[model samples]
Target: MMKKIILHGATNCGSSNFGDFLYGVAVYNYIKENYKDIEVGFYNPSEYFIKYIGDCKISLSKSDMLIYIPGGYFGQSHKSRFIDNAIQFVRFMPVGIKAIFKSIKIGVIGIGAGPIISPFLKYPIKMIGNKAEMISTRDNESYNALKSLGLDNILELSDLILALNIHNLSDTTDQVVDICKKCEGRKLLFVHYNHSLLARDIFARQLDTFVEENPEYQLVVGSDCLLSYDDEYYIEFSKRVKKNCIQFNYDSPFELIALLERVDAVLTCKLHVGVVATMLNKPVVCFAEHPEKTKRYYRQINQPDRCVSLYDTSEEEMLSILKDKIFEKSFVPDEEIDKAKRNFDVLNELINKK
Candidate 1:
C-alpha cells in the first residue's frame, strides 16, 4: 500500500507572494521525484484547515506522516506585539497537536526561526519539536533559536527552493515564457522589495536613478507575493521610475521561475527573492530586512558581502553595490548544493522508516 504523506507549509499556489508558493511547490516536487512509492499532498494551514477540520480529519485518517516545509511562520517575528505574535505562533498548534495526538510521524524541512525572545512560545515550540521525526532548519540563526529551547537534534540545511528543479517551468509558453522570449537578448534586471523593510519613496528614487543611469538594461519590478501591500508597493515604485519599468505577477511557480531564469540579476529586500535569484544562477544584491533571517542564508552559502541594510547605507551606496553586481559573475557553491541534497536525503529517510 502506498503510504500517504502531507507536505504542509504556507502554500497558496501562485499566490502573489511567489516565494511561499515556490517553497510549497519545491516540497511537493522533492517528494514526487524521490519517493515514488509514497502518495503526496500539499496543505496550507491558514488557507485549508481553519474552516475544514472535518476535511483534515478525513485526510489524517489515511496519512502516515506530515512534513512541514520551509517558511518564517514558525517564529514570533511578524509585526505584532508580544501577545499578538504569541497568538499567531499557536495558530497551527491545533493541527500539529492533532497530528501528534494521532501518533502520525511529523517532520520539518528547511524552516526559518529567530529572535524568539518570548517564553510563552517555548512550550508550543517544544511540543512541535518533540513530535517531529526529523528537524532541519534553513539557517544557523533558526537552528540556534530552536536550540535555545532545548531541541538540539536539528540539522542545518540550505533553503529548499535552492534545490528546487525550476527547469520544469519551461514546459509551457505562458505569459512569463512569452516575456522571456520577447526580451531574449536584452539585459534584464528584476526588482522585488518589501514596503515593511524600507521607505518606498526612497527606494523608488534610488531605483529611478539606477534605471536612468543604466539605460541599456530592462527594468522589471515585481512582487514576490500578491499581498495587497505587495502590489501597492510595486505600483508606487513603478511610478517613480521615470524610465520605463515593467510590472508583472504570476499565479504559477513554474511561470515565475521561467521569468526569473531570464533576468540578469535580482535586487530585493526579501529573503526568498534573493534565494530564488541565486538558485537561477543570477547575482543577488539584497537590502537586509531581518538580520538573522536575511543575512544568515547568504553567509551560510559564503556570500555575506551581498547583504546590506537600508538603514546603514545611502541610496547612492546601495546603487553602487547594484552597479558592481550588474557586472559581477555569480555561481552557486557546490557545498551548498551538497548540503541541500543531504537535507532531502535525511527527510526521505525519516519518512520511509518503518
Candidate 2:
C-alpha cells in the first residue's frame, strides 16, 4: 500500500502561469479526495533540488511514489529558451533517477510532449519515459512522439485540467465582477497573447478589424500567465488595438475562471486559456505558436478548425475565423472528460495493489 507520494510539476516552483498552478491544484485535490490515507508532499526540484540533491534523495526515498503532474514539460516552446528547458530537465532528471534507485514508483501523467527538436532535450525525456512506472500523455502528438522514441509504457490520455471540478471554486472576485458589470451589454471576447511582439502586432491588427466590423463585441485583454512580460504584452496590446479594451489582471486560477465565466468567448495564444474556456463551454479560437499541443487538443474535442497558426494565418483570415468561432457553439464531450480522469488510473491501481 502507498503511504507517501510527492507531487512534482512546474506549479510547485511558484510558476506564475495560472494553468500550471491549476494543474498542481487539480492533482493535489484529486489525491486528497481519492487517496485519503496517503501522505502528500510537493517536491519542487527546480528551486533547490540540484544543490541539495542528497537531501532530496533522502526525502524522496521515504515516499512510496513520485507523481510528475501535468503540463507541457517534455517539449520546447518558442516562449522558453533552450537553456531554460535544459535547466528544467537537469533539475528533474536526478530526482527521477534517485526515486528509481530507491524503488519509489514514478508516474508521469497528463503531460504534453514533442516538437523536441534537440537531441539534448529528447534523450533525457526518453530516459525518464523509459524509467517511469507509467507515463500518460495528454495529447496524441505526445503519445506518438514517446512511442517513436521506443518507450512502451506510455498511454494517451486527455489533459488533467479537464477533470477539474470548476463548480467548487470560490465566487468571482468583486473586481472581476465589477469589470463584467461595467461591460454588461457588450459581448466580451477574452484575449490573451504570447510575448512575441510580431504575433502581438498581427493579432492586434486582426482584432482591430474584428471589433471595427462587429461593434457588439468588446475585447478583454489579459493573461493566463502572471509573468511580468505577459502583463506587459497585454498592456501593450490594448494600446495598439483601435477599439477600447479592458485590461484584466487576475491573482488566482479562481479569479481567472471567474473572468472566463463572465466572457462570451476566448481568443488566445496560450494553450490552457483556450483549454479552460473550452471546459467552460465558451467558444475559443487559438493562435498557436507551437501548434502541436493546441491543435491536438482541438482535434481531440472534434473542434479542429478552432486551432490556427499564429504566424502563417493572415490578418484578414484571422479576423474571419475569429468572427466565425467567437459565436460558435462549443462543448467538451462527456467521454473526453472521462478520458481525462483516466490520467490518474495508473496511480490509483498502484495504490490499491496488495
Candidate 3:
C-alpha cells in the first residue's frame, strides 16, 4: 500500500514566507516527479494538529514519515540573544543530546521517514526519519549541521535550484523592462547590496556620484530593494538629481542568467546571483553580507575574491574592481558546476527510493 507522508517544515516567523516559497516548491516538485502515486501532504504545526499540541488525542495520528527543514516543526532559534539563543541551541541541538536520555524510546517502527535539513528537533523526530526507508539533504552545510546534531542524513550535495528554474520568466519581458527603466545607461551595472552590509545608501550615493561624472555607466537598482516598494520610491530616489539610475529584477534565475550574459557585469548582494554568475563565467562582485557565509563560499574555490566586499565597497573602488574583473576572466570552472549537477542527479535518485 502507498504510505501517507508529510514534509512539514514551515513556520510563522519573520522569513517563513520566503522559506515556504522555496521549500514548498521543492517538496511539491519532488512529489510530482518522483512519488507520483503516493499520497503526500504538507502542513505547518497549526494545520497538523489544529490546536496547541499538548497531550492531544487527534495529534497522535502519525504519518509514515516526516521530512523537515529546521526551524519549522519547532520554533525559531533566538535571533541575537543569550538566553533565547541558549534555549534555541539546545532545542535544535543534535539528536545525541537527547539520546543520553535512553529511557525515552526512539525508533522507526510505526513512524516511517523524517529527514531533516537543520540540526534542531526531538531526537525521536530525527531517529525515526533516519530509520526510514530513504532520506537525503541538498547542501553540505545542511549535512554537516545534521551530523553535528548526531544525525548523518547523508550529504546530497544538491542545491535548492533542483526545484527552481529560470526560463519560465522569458515571457515576462515587460516586467523586466518596467523594472530596468528605473536605471538606464550603457555599460550599466546592477548593484545589490546585502541587508547585512547596511551600505546600500552609502553605495547608492557612491553610484550616484559616479554616474554624475562617468556618463558611460549607470548603477542600476536590483529587485531585492523593491520589497513593499512602489513607483514613488523610484521617483523619490531620483528627485534629487535630473533623473534616478535605473533598476531591474529578473523574473527568474534563468532570466537573470540571460540578463547576466548580456550585461557588462553584476555587483550583487545576493549569493544565488554570485553562484549563477560564477557558473556562467560572468564577471561579478559579491558584497560580503554575513561574514561567515561569505567566507565559506569564498574559500570553496579561489577567485571568490573576484566578488568584492562592502568594506571595500566604494563606488569608485567597486567601479575600479568591476573594470578589472571585466578582464580578469576567472569564474568557476565548468567541472565544478557539472559536479553540483551530478550531485543533484544522485540526490534525485535517492529521494525517489521506494
Model 3 per-residue lDDT tens digits across residues 245-334: 665542233344456545566666555556555555556666655333443344554675565556645667766665566444445544
Which of 1 and 3 is ahead in TM-score?
1
Per-residue CA lDDT of model 1 for 106-204, tens digit only, reads 888887876666665667778888878778988778888888888866998777767756676443446665566555567788877655536466667
lDDT of 2 at 209: 82
Index of the highest-TM-score prediction: 2
Number of clashes found in candidate 3: 13
Ranked by lDDT, the better of candidates 2 and 3 is 2
Q: What do the candidate models score in CA lDDT, each in turn?
A: 0.69, 0.77, 0.45
TM-scores, each model vs. reference: 0.85, 0.89, 0.61
**Global local distance difference test of model 3:** 0.45
Give the root-mean-square deviation of each candidate in angstroms. 3.9, 4.0, 8.1
TM-score, cand. 3 vs. native:
0.61
How close to the true structure is residue 128 of candidate 2, measured as C-alpha lDDT?
A: 72
Clashes in candidate 1: how many? 7
